[model samples]
Target: MRIRSDGLAARSFDAETVVLDLEKSQYLTLNETGSLLYELLRQERTMDELVDAVVAEYNVDRVIAMRDVEAFVGSLREHGLLTGSDVLA
Candidate 1:
């Protein structure tokens, strides 16, 4: 899915990503890998694409990449950072 831009703002610095959820008055800081995934989500990505990106970027095992990607996406969902019906698809 895509990032919700309505009341959210995001910035990247070095290998980190910072997201400001103006509607919620909350903010989140993401590490390097999280930043990569977040940037990808700016467009639209399926779960497999996310996992593959992690694997290609870090040379991690597919299983590990899948796990990490899921956790990252779940965290984004928990924080209400994602939009569109395909977010969890």
Candidate 2:
């Protein structure tokens, strides 16, 4: 599936990512890994692509990378960062 990041004003600082949801009036801060993942999510990507991105950027194991990416996506979904339309095949 592909993820979308609409209605967000995001900025990256060093290894951190900050996003402000104009509609929700909420903001989120992400660490190094999260920042990279967030950047990737701006484009359409499969789950594997997300994992591969983390693995390539960091020296983490494949399993750990996948787990972290999944967790991050889950958090993003839970926070309403990605909407139903943002998710597509």
Tens digit per residue, CA lDDT, model 2, 1-89: 33445677988888898999888899999999888877877776777888888888887899998788878888988888764432313
| Candidate 1 structure lDDT | 0.87
Candidate that would win on TM-score: 1
The superposed Cα distance between candidate 2 and the true structure at residue 69, in angstroms, equals 0.6
Colliding residue pairs in candidate 1: none
Total clashes in model 1, counting residue pairs 3 or more apart in sequence or in different chains: 0
Instruction: Give the residue spans of candidate 1 off by over 4 A.
Output: 85-89
Alpha-carbon error at 55 in model 1, in Å?
0.4
Cα lDDT listed for each candidate: 0.87, 0.78
TM-score of 2: 0.84
Where model 2 places Cα greater than 4 Å from the true spot, the runs are: 1-5, 83-89
